[model samples]
Target: MTEPAWKSPTDARAEFRGGLRVPTAGWCAGWTQANLIAVPRALAYDMLLYAQRNPRPCPVLDVSDPGVVSTRLFGGDLRTDLPAYRIFERGELVGEVADARAVWRDDLVAFLIGCSFTFEAALAEAGVTLRHQEMGVNVPMYRTSLRTLPAGRLGGPLVVSMRPVPASLVATAVKVTARYPAVHGAPVHVGDPRTIGVTDLDAPDFGDPVEVRPGELPVFWACGVTPQAAVMESKPDFAIGHAPGHMGITDARDSEYLVP
Candidate 1:
């Protein structure tokens, strides 16, 4: 069997065009993307509990029935819906595929979690430079010493994404993101990485590290990966998520998720 390709929802949609169904990048733009988790019905409740216990890292958006593949909540099909699916057995990555039709089970449930990419457009509009986009690399993510509130079957250290911001714009970045709590809200930590147990700014637990210049301070925010880290430690029988940077886009606008 060929290993499955993991493409973001946008890339997947673009590749679905005629003559090619391969994994491609740069699909949908400006749409809200999401992190996904699939588990057996037996463990769904506990998983939702896990999400509730850790809202910063695992905010819940939608959930499908035990055996259903249709999720109208975000207005997208769960099967042949996005560009790809990842299979994990006992916390191990077994393979990646274009679709999960072959392994669909009646007891499987899908959970959609908010992603930080939802704020990228807003940041650009504000003139905040996203180093990862400039370098054409994934955002830097680190596992912090912080502990998340534990629930039924999940608990672990917090994971955060980092972006280098010019000292002048760091404050503005916080105010802009504070408006969108559904997508991770504001900065969790700024200036020093050691305060969060991240010693080497050059190496991250996930994603590529961008350059931190003389006047720039490393800004960090709670990341969706926090839930993934928790799930790995929880050792649930099964679960799935978007390969970092990849997310499912929804019809909702960014302002819709902002707090008053």
Candidate 2:
């Protein structure tokens, strides 16, 4: 099927509703991209607490009321908004699907976590570059040894997405991204990946790697995938989340997430 060129969140979501499964990194530019996570009501409290405790990696943007697909901040259906989803059963990935409607239950709660893509364009305008976006690949993500605060049984190593920024613009990238608190703000680690437990940049546990040119630094930001890592470690009975780079583009703008 031919996909329509999407210039708006509505358009991106409409395409996703039609079974399009593309990385949302470069889509709906300037819109707030969200990491989706849905768990049964029994586990929703722990997940909510986990996000609250680890705001950088799992910033809570908008959470759905139990059994409700609609959120107060955005007008959209959560069930078919994102292009790809991963279903987990007891810490194991059971399947990848285009939509999670089949697993929807009256007691299910959905979480829309903030994404760093919300700040990438600002960094670009500030003279920082995005190698992964330039190379047309998913942003590189690694499992870090940094542990998130334990909330109930949900706790694990923090996950980070790596972006190679020019050494000259490294400070600018940090300053620009720090303004957006809802999104994972600022670079947590700005140098050697080994310092953060990543053995190799080319072998990311999630997403694709970008080149680190000479005089460039590998900048790491807390990634929303951190929750999924916790899911894998804690082995919840069931959970659903956005697949890697695929995100939910909300009606909200990136500017809305920026703090003064």
Candidate 3:
């Protein structure tokens, strides 16, 4: 995928002054991508607690202070740096915009959560084919009966993203991703949807489902969707997320966060 053209220094500075600009996910090739959420400072600790309680789904990458736009951990300016942002008001997605300037607030604290994009580079390195990238569609995801530990006002079922791996490569995929426990780690379950409460694999709750060939297995992962599910169920007054495929690129390399 071609990276989006970088704006001129003057244009970038102007954007930072006026508002934030969303970068295309393709722009940050090889860098770890992240899912972002901004919440009021009063609820920050509670949300962090929830993330801690459910590490598989809500693996945290970094957390920013109230009114602070710069994320020191990822070397990013929260205001206009990501590729896109989804704004939710009273649990409803009000808009999908490139940046979060109009609704930026001083009392908001930003949270950066680990995303499966962190491991995509590794998968590619191992020669595992990614169906979504090949077909130019978003990954398939679903809400499962698996429930996350409740913290403060946050509590809900777990959401997962799916990838169809060849039967021969399933073990390799698991072995490779198992090294990154802090960013979702290993597969929660494999080959069976009913075990996870999925009635039909063809119709996913989110994203497009890819075909499982004669020799392929439908492997599921604990997705970054856990946070979004919490948002939907708890109905946070307001929230923000990165647009699908467009993630917040960071200075952190994929290997650094691995458990070894």
Candidate 4:
């Protein structure tokens, strides 16, 4: 039998380069899918400090040495691994590209932030069906009125990813995810999106929103993309990030991110 294209990290990159531009959820399940951010060496320290201050949404996984394209934690080029890349020039999203090879820079620093997809995999194992995955769409993400602790020029509204969990299993979802603090631990907010300034669940700031079925509580998690949100506010001269829901698949197992 031919193995699925996304089953291997290498193959996943190939699939992405082959023009597969959609959410990476449920693809390469059990492996880690990271949020990628590449910034000039000048802002690297501020970004690092930002991640440290806002660890819930910006947990550090692997940070590449300046000019390095290969990852120490995974076997893939930083420039070409992710499914999609978002380029931000002067705080505004200028373009979405398939790979960032052309814009690769010697002074660029790439950070691989922990993603909730690992926890989502755990949730799936615990029988919490990810509605977005089932519906074949990106998990909904929202830009909240909540603010992240600022680090230099790197600070902005907190970004969150939403998943509608069965009301009965909301507790189970929380418990299962709480074990992986490095990968966004657990639900930060549940129930009312208005509490977080999410006016409508149907229309998300980023990614496609899934239906909130009757009796399903919309569970929210601090997202890896929070840095991107912060970057939008800070508006560096140049920056690169993974498109929401499109992530850099890594060889590390999801269990590697679990806490005792």
Model 2 agreement with the true structure over 17-42: per-residue lDDT tens digits: 89988887767777888998888899
lDDT of each: 0.72, 0.88, 0.76, 0.89
Best by TM-score: 4
TM-score of 3: 0.87
- Per-candidate TM-score against the hidden true structure: 0.85, 0.96, 0.87, 0.96
How does candidate 1 fare on TM-score? 0.85
Estimate, for each residue in 162-207, the C-alpha lDDT of model 3 and write its tens digit.
8888888999999888988877888897898888998888898877
lDDT of 1 by residue, 12-116 (tens): 444432123322122244556677778888888877897888787787877887777756555655655554666676777676655666766778888888777
| Per-residue C-alpha lDDT of model 4 across residues 1-260, encoded as one tens digit per residue | 33433487778877777777878888786788899989999999999999999999999999999978868776788887777899999999999998788877899999999999888778988999988888988899999989999999888999999999999999999999999988889888999999999999999999997999999999999999999998899999999999999998888888888887
For residue 249, model 1's alpha carbon misses the true position, in angstroms, by 2.0
C-alpha RMSD between model 2 and the true structure: 1.9
Worst 10 residues of 2 by lDDT: 1-10
Q: How would you order the candidates by TM-score, starting with the best? A: 4, 2, 3, 1
Candidate 2 residue pairs in clash (backbone atoms < 3 Å): none
